[model samples]
Target: MSEREVLELLRENARYGTDDIARITGLDEDDVEATIAALEEAGVVRGYQAVVDWDELEDERVRAVVELNVTLDRETGYADIASRLARFPEVTALRLVSGDYDFDMEVEGDSIREVSRFVSEKVAPVPEITQTVTHYVMTAYKENGIEFGDGDEDDRLSYSP
Candidate 1:
């Protein structure tokens, strides 16, 4: 099997062993192992992760997407401010976006108040940050290409004729 095929199989299921991948792809087990090692070394395969349904857990959490408009530094631009924002524990994801906002960030906290506090107290105080808009996530139907709940059921009630 080609390297691309091996990568595809690994992407579908990161836990697949070398023997399992070799059997499916019709390649030798050692070849599969070597290809995976090469991919990891090259930084193509960053790390394996389990997608957890955080909503189902006993402790409730709040997630919010924050849009930030910032004054860019003449020398470093958004990179300096973005790197500083990334260091916050509450920030799960940060991206330099193209549009009305300079940066889009995903953050999680114990409650709405906590998320608001982070934005107001922490993010707002940054010298470069001019404005921020926070949108809290209410429900997650799907995440990371995986469905969260029953696939067959519709959210709306069936109508009676």
Candidate 2:
């Protein structure tokens, strides 16, 4: 199969095995395996991941994204700060980016107070983190692997239940 075809298969489901891809793409299983291996070696295919709906689980949890704007100080290590934040199980994602915020973090906790404590006691204390903004998600119209599919892909869409 061509690169475009392989990409489409990956887009459909990244975790699909080479045999499955071969069946779908009408290519030899070895070719499919080679293509995937090449994609991985070239750093095009990073890895396979499973998407989980944590909210559906019988656990009391809240998810929030905390945006941090930091003054880049030469002394305090940014990685150290990130590592410190990750010590708590609540922190799920920590990313540094070029924008108004230095870091965008996704966190989950058993309760609102627990989440708040993580922000105050853990996150807020990181030096150079001059500003921290916390947004508690009331409802995510779309998130993670969840996409709202309407017939018109170009149309502005809203999710209503």
Q: Which numbered prediction scores highest in lDDT against the true structure?
A: 1
- State the TM-score for model 1: 0.84
Point out where model 1 deviates above 4 Å.
152-161
Model 2, residue pairs in steric clash: none
Pairing residues by index, what is the TM-score of model 2?
0.68
With candidate 1 superimposed using the best TM-score fit, by how many Å does residue 111's alpha carbon deviate from the native? Answer: 2.0
Q: Residues 1-161, candidate 2: write the lDDT tens digits.
A: 36668877886788788888888889998888888778889988777676655555787668899998777567677787788777778888899888777889999987889998889888788777788899987655555555534334655457656
Cα lDDT tens digits, model 1, 1-161, are 47999999877888888899999989999999899999999999988898778888999899999999999667767889988999999999999989999899999999999999999999999989999999999888887778898677666757856
- Candidate 1 minimal-lDDT segment of 10 residues: 152-161
Error of 2 at 56 (Å): 4.1
